[model samples]
Target: MDHIKKVGVIGSGTMGAGITQLMVQNGCATVLFDIDKETVDKAKESIGSRLERLVEKKKISTEEMILAKELLQTTTDMNMFKDCQLVIEAAPEKIEIKRSIFQQLEKICAKDTVLTTNTSSLSITEISGQIENPRRVAGYHFFNPAPIMPLVEVVQGLQTAPETIEVLVQFAEGLNKKPVVCKDTPGFIVNRVARPFYNEALRIMNDQVASVEQVDRIMKSAGNFKMGPFELQDLIGIDVNFATTQSVHASFYGESRFRPHYYQERMVQSGSLGRKTKGGFYNYD
Candidate 1:
């Protein structure tokens, strides 16, 4: 893939801010965008604090951290992204919201510029189709804490060009991330493969096979996972997790195996999303 010197990241949430920090740390000028000025300012502050912590831990030199912060620009204008080589949208998961951002990005960005979405659940095929040049649009889903996560899912939609995927594979690798190319299906790879983990765990709990704590312990010891399903769910946000499950389940047209459990729905419905709220399936409070 050709060199990507400038990156535009839409949204200021944990995922988006982390992406900006990582891109800048890798020597790319990153422009971060959000709808509101306050959100952008908060994101900037969050990134600064994170970098400061890294410096304190001796993970990065203080000078390097300052340079990384200098490389990051925060903005609310989509027009600012016109010069970006690759623009990654990390906006909310709503399809309409993403489509709107794509429409705006297509208008502001050049024809050769690649438009990528960091959408974990939605279909890249559908998201790309909403834009003018679907061939140039693709999924570039990153795991939570993008700066630290090793894996990146480089998904190609039905109409995505091979060169686009190739570009991203190199791009992700340059960021010190392992990129895995996959066809843009419902949940793609990791999400699909990992679905049964959460679903079956819920099923087992409901069936009295084990309690949530026992299931987590067993999975961690025997399954060799850093975190069990319930623990991971709490960390990822129950609402966000449930939404992804629902999206995948819906994308599969209500396949029984992909069905989301009501217990998760209850967690979301009750507004007990997760760690952000200081509680979830396993209470943090």
Candidate 2:
């Protein structure tokens, strides 16, 4: 497996910043890109702060943190990704946005540069459908808190080459993430298996069977899970979680099981999007 030395992450949002931090910390020269200069600059600051925290905690030395920071580069220009051996599209989960990014990347990067999407539920095949090299396009879904999350779903689109899957699996492992290969499917694996977890919790609350806090408590204690569905939703962003449910539901052709609850939609509409917004199922403020 070829080792990916230089990586590019498109979008400087939460996932994008986390991925950039992870790459640089793992010794890869990383380029973080966003259309907005301010957003990208803030992301770099956030990444730096996180590394400082790790240094304070003794997880990494001062030298290591300095080296990681040195390896990171932030840019508002998409053309800066030309030299990246692997470019992960951590842009918004919208299919059109992802398609446009991959299309643009195809023109900017080398033919063999692996173009991967961090979309949790969007169809990888559809996103890369119009790209010149569909085989190089695959889904590289990472959980929230990319540096800490161990599981990475390596999704193979219908046209994704076997070599592409192999490269991604190796790259993911190189980053110390556990990679699971799966065919293109709605919600892939974790999100699909976990959809009912959130939906049912919302249903129970909506039906007055339990309060939000009560539901989370029960799941953590009874289910032996680290976090309850509602609490997890708050961390993952209500809008993002809701969008995944909607995507899976549509992919399954309105399957009742994957249906998104209106309460979640209402939270999104209300702009109570979770930790970032300081409010969601539970208030951070």
Candidate 3:
């Protein structure tokens, strides 16, 4: 963790920005990158606002917030990541896009710099296969709302080195996150175990066995889960959740247990992508 004084995060979306905030809060000099200057700037502003809210809530001192803001740097250039000891690619869940970003990072970063992906379901080995040093490529899958999520899946690809995994585990702990090591399996651990939670809820709603609200209510009251499947999907983005289910299902060669519900596809196609779009199983509008 001491060796990882600087970090870089790509994509500048919700997950990327969250990871950047976590890094800076933990005293790492962080560079948040995106292709669009406007997008990166927006992410920077959003992170700053979140830090301010934490200070207002007394979760963080004003001085801590100031230091965190100072530690953060936003950029539209990929070359700015050249000196980062660790780079976490929070790009979209596309194999080609992730691979391309890693390939570009391979050229820009130092040979020993650890490269990780925040992919929920993509194969880490495939993402790093084309790069020169696959041993340095691993998965650092943080849950949504990274600053609040305690568990981080430190995934080891077939080619990933033991040293790389150790470094990631220590780094995650340094960020005050609980790190669990897992192999480079599709959906790794949490997402794999959680598929049934979302899939069966969708199935129940699709079969008219229960309404979305009913299912969520039961899960919260009887199942004792913090958030019901439908509610969680809305928070996670219906499209993102559906895509993860599809990826896991396909990865298992169309296993029935991991099958996605048609209603999820319909929601995604309709562009009611959970809270972000103001609608999904429930409407925010």
Top candidate by lDDT? 3
> Candidate 2, residue 244: CA error in Å?
0.7
TM-score of each: 0.96, 0.98, 0.98
Candidate 1 stretches greater than 4 Å from native: none
Task: Return the clash pairs for model 3, or none.
Answer: none
Ranking 1 against 2 by lDDT, winner: 2
Against the true structure, candidate 1 reaches a TM-score of 0.96
lDDT of 1 by residue, 114-138 (tens): 9999998898888777677899989
Looking at model 2, residue 16 earns an lDDT score of: 95
> Among all windows of ten consecutive residues in candidate 3, which has the lowest summed lDDT?
198-207
- Scored by lDDT, model 3 comes in at 0.94
lDDT of 3 by residue, 22-112 (tens): 9999899999999999999999999999999999999999999999999999999999999999999999898999999999999999999
Candidate 3 wrongly placed segments (more than 4 Å): none
Candidate 2 has a TM-score of 0.98
Q: Assess candidate 2 and give its lDDT.
A: 0.93
